[model samples]
Target: MAKNKHSGKIVQNSRLLVGLVLLVLSIPYSAEARQKPNILWINCDDLGKELSSYGNQQVHTPVIDRLAREGQVFTNAYANAPVCSSSRSSQILGLYPTRLPILNHRNMSPVALPDSVPTIMQLFREAGYFCSNGAAGDLAKPGKEDYNFVAEDLFDGTDWRQRQEGQPFFAQVQIHEPHRTFVHDELHPIDPAEISLPALYPDHPLIRADWARYLESVQRADRWVGEILDRLEEDGELESTIVILYGDHGRPHLRDKQWLYEGGLAVPLIIRYPNSLNAGKVDHRLISLVDISASTLGLAGLPIPIDWDGKDIIGGAKNSYIYGFRQRCGDAVDDIRSISDGEYKLIWNRMPEQPYMQLSSYKKLQYPAYTLYRDLDQKGELSAPFSAFMATTKPDYELYHLKVDPYEIENLADNPAYQGELLRLKEQLERQLQAVETYPQEESEALIQQAKSSSRKYYQEAMQRRNLGPDPTDAEILDYWNHELLLNQKPKTKK
Candidate 1:
C-alpha cells in the first residue's frame, strides 16, 4: 500500500512539471522573442546628406528629422561604392565591393550573388521573421521580381500595412524621389538664391534651377516617410520596430556618382530604434553601409556571418577607415579608385597625365549644374567653387588632407612633407583589400592593363583636341571636363 502511494505522488509531480513548461511556452516572450526583433530597412536612391536634421537646413526632410529625434544619427557614414549596383550589392551580400567579381556599374550581366550568401532578409527569415521588400528603382536584383515580396508601390505604405499579426518581419522600403532626371517645375517652395551651393558647382541660373528640383524630390521623399511612420504608430509597432533610413550613394552629378570623391560615396545614415536606442544621439565614427548587415543580425541576436566584410556598428564605435570605389566608363574617362579615413582622402588613377575636367563632371551632366559649369568656364568667369571641380593633371596618386581642405581643392600626394602619412594609409588599404577573399585573381592584371591602355588612348585624343584650341564659345570643353571627371578612373579592385 505504501509503494502504491509513492507511485501516485511521482505521477502527480510529472503532471505539474509539464503544466509549468506549457505555461512558459504560452508566454508572449520568454527571452526568445527579444532575440527576434522586427527590422525595417529604408533606402533612398542617389540621396546624400541633404536632410535638415543632418545639418542641411536647405533641404526639408521632417520625417527623417523626427527619426533622428528618436534614435541615433551617424554623421560619418559612407557607401561601399558611389554607384547604385555595387553599393546595393555590398549591402545585400554583407561584403565589400572589392570582394565581388562583377559589381561594376552598367555591366548588364547579372553578377549573381550566391544563394549561400545570407542577406538581411534571409537572416531574419531563418530566425522566424517574414521578409518583404518594396523597391522604387531598378537598383536591386535585375530580374528577381519576387525578391521575397511583391508590393506594387516601392515607396507606398501597402506592404507595411499587410504584415502578419503576431509574427516578426523584415521589411525594406525604397523611395524613387531625389534621383536624377528630376522634373524642374515641381520643386519645393524654397528660393534658389538661398541655397548654399557646393564648392564644385558654378553659380549659374540653370544649376540653381536644378538644385531646386533636387530639393523638391527630397521634400516628396520626406512626405512619404511621414506617412509610413504614422502607419507604424497607428499599428502600435513603432516602439518594437527598428527603422533604418539611408542613401544608396551620393547625388547625381559630374563629381558625385561615378567618382570616388566625398560627393559620390559619402551618404547619410539614420537608425531609429525606439526601444533600444537613445534619442538625439550622434555617432561620428566611420561606418559603411555594408556594416548594416552585421548590425541587423546582431540586433536580432544572431551571429554575423563569417563572409561579411562589415563590422557591427550598433555599439556606436568601429574601425576608423572608409573605402570607396567606382567602375563606370562615362563620357571621356575610364576607371578610378579612392579611400578615406574620416580626415584624409586618396584617389588612385589609372590615367594620370590627363587634365581633370570641371564642367564635364558626371553629376553635372545629369542635372542643371551642367549648364552652369559650361557657361562659367566658357566665359572664363570661374569662381573658387567652380574651379574646385577642375581636377588637376593628377600624378599617379592624388591625396587630400580633408581636415585642412574639406572641399579637396588642394592635392598633397606629390608633397614630400607628408610621405609618412600617405605611405601608412596606403599600406593599411592594401592589407584590408587583401584580407577580403572576394577579390578576383586577375584584378591587378586587368587594372594595370586597362590603366596603361586608357592613358595612351586618352593622351593621343586629348593632344589632338588640345591642338584645336578652345572655341571661344565652345561648350564641349566644359562638357568634356564634367564628363571626364565623372569617368575618372574610380574602379574599385574589389578585393
Candidate 2:
C-alpha cells in the first residue's frame, strides 16, 4: 500500500468527489425545509356560520364554500369573547382578555400592552416576518385594528406586497361586512321568507326582512374573500400561504352578538394549508379563537411562547372546553361568562338584576327583535319561552345541553338530572376565574344612567327616521320596514 503514491492520490480524489455530490444534493432540501409559511388571516366582522359551507343555503357564499371544500373545517370554534375588541385582544396575544383587562368593548382610554406581554405580530416581526394589518376593502386602506389596546403604527405597513423580497409575511385583513346597518345586497338579494329565523326571536315580518339583509351582507363579504384569494393567487402567493378565513364573532342579531348564547360565541373556522394539504378534513373539537394564535405560530414553524394561554392545536391536541365572557359592552354593565364542551354549555350571569334586553343603545336602534319583545311584553302577550329569556330580570345561572336543545331556550340549571354536568362546568369556571383578574361584581351607576339616556335618545331618533309615531304598534313598524324593502313600491305615509 505504501509503494504507489499516484494510486493513493486517485482514491483520495474519488472520496472528495462523492462528498461534494452529497453536499450539493442536501442544500435544496435544507432550504425547502427551512422555508417558513406566509400567514393570511381573513377576518369578516359579525359573520356567523350561515354560509352554504355551514349548511345554510340561504347564505350564498361561494368563495367561503370553496375554502371549506379545499381546507380543514373547524365545526366548533368560538370567540373567547363575543364582542370585537375583547375577542381580538384575547386572540392577538393568545391569552384571556380578563388577564389583560381588555374585556370591555372599547375602553374610553385604552391601556397599552405591558412590557412582558408580546403580541403574535410582535413575535412574528421578531422572527423577521413582515407583519401587515390592512382593510380588505376596495380601497387599499389600513385595516381596522379596532383592538381596544393602543395599536397605532404597531404594524409594518398596510400591504403584504410591500414586504422585503423573499421575506415571509403575516397579514390580517379586515372585511367589514354583516356587522350592522345591513341593507339588501342588490347584487345578491336573499328572500326574507327563506331565512330560517331562530326561535329566540318573534317570527315577525320585520325580523325576517332583517335576517334576509344579514345574509345579503354575508354574500357581499364572501365576494370580498374571493377578491383577496384571487389577489393572492395572481401574485403567486396563494400556494405558499396559509390562508385562514373566520368570523370575529357571531352574527349581529338579537341573541347573537354581545351575548353568551351559542349564536354569539360560535364562529366558523376554515384553514387552507399551503397547496391544499389535508384538504376536506373536518375537526369537531371545541376550540377558542385564542388557540388560533398559538396554532398559527406552530404552522409557521415558530416556537410558541410558553406563557401563552393557548396551546398549539395544529398538532391535533385540543382543549376539552372553550370559554367566553362579556363585560360592559356598549355601556351595559352585566358581567357574563360561559363555557361549552361542544355539546353542553353553561352561563353565569353574575349580575342577573340587569336584564338580557337591557338599555344598550346600538341594539335598540339596530335590532328589530328588541322592539317586538318590548311591545309583546307590554300587551302581556309574551309567552313561556320568550318571557323567560326576555324578562325584566334573568336567572343567576343558565345551563343547556346543546345537542338536544340547539336554541338554548330551556334552562336546566335547576334540573336534578343535570346536576353533575352543571357542577363540572361551574367548578371549571371557578378555576378559570381564579387564574385571571377578578371580575367586577357591582355595576357603575354613572355608566348605567349614561347608557340608558343615550339609548333612549338614539331609539327615539331611530324611530323617527323610520316615520314611526312615539308609540307605534308592531304592525306600524313592519309597515315601514316592508316599504323600505320594496323600493319599487310607494313609501308608506307617516302615522
lDDT of each: 0.64, 0.79
Question: Candidate 1's residue-wise lDDT over 1-495, tens digit each?
Answer: 012221122223323443454356654333565446677888888787889987889887778898998888989988877777678767865777666453455332334444344456555544546666665433242222222111232221226444555766677777766786553334456677788887666666556656766777788878767766776788887888989888888877666776777888888888888675778889888998889888877776665665467788994438778887665432334456677888888787756655556223233334435455556666778776456554466466778898878767677887999787788778877776666534442234455456445544544454345442322123544444333333323322212
Q: Model 2 RMSD to the real structure? A: 11.8
TM-score, per-candidate, Cα-based: 0.75, 0.87
**TM-score for model 1?**
0.75
User: Which stretches of candidate 2 lie above 4 Å from their native place?
Assistant: 1-34, 438-482, 486-495
lDDT of 1 at 319: 74
Indicate which candidate wins on TM-score: 2
Model 2 clashing residue pairs (backbone): 134-143, 135-143
Location of the lowest summed lDDT over 10 successive residues in candidate 2: 1-10
Span of ten consecutive residues with least summed lDDT in model 1: 1-10
Error of 2 at 417 (Å): 1.0
For model 2, what is the error of residue 19's alpha carbon versus the real structure, in angstroms, after optimal superposition? 34
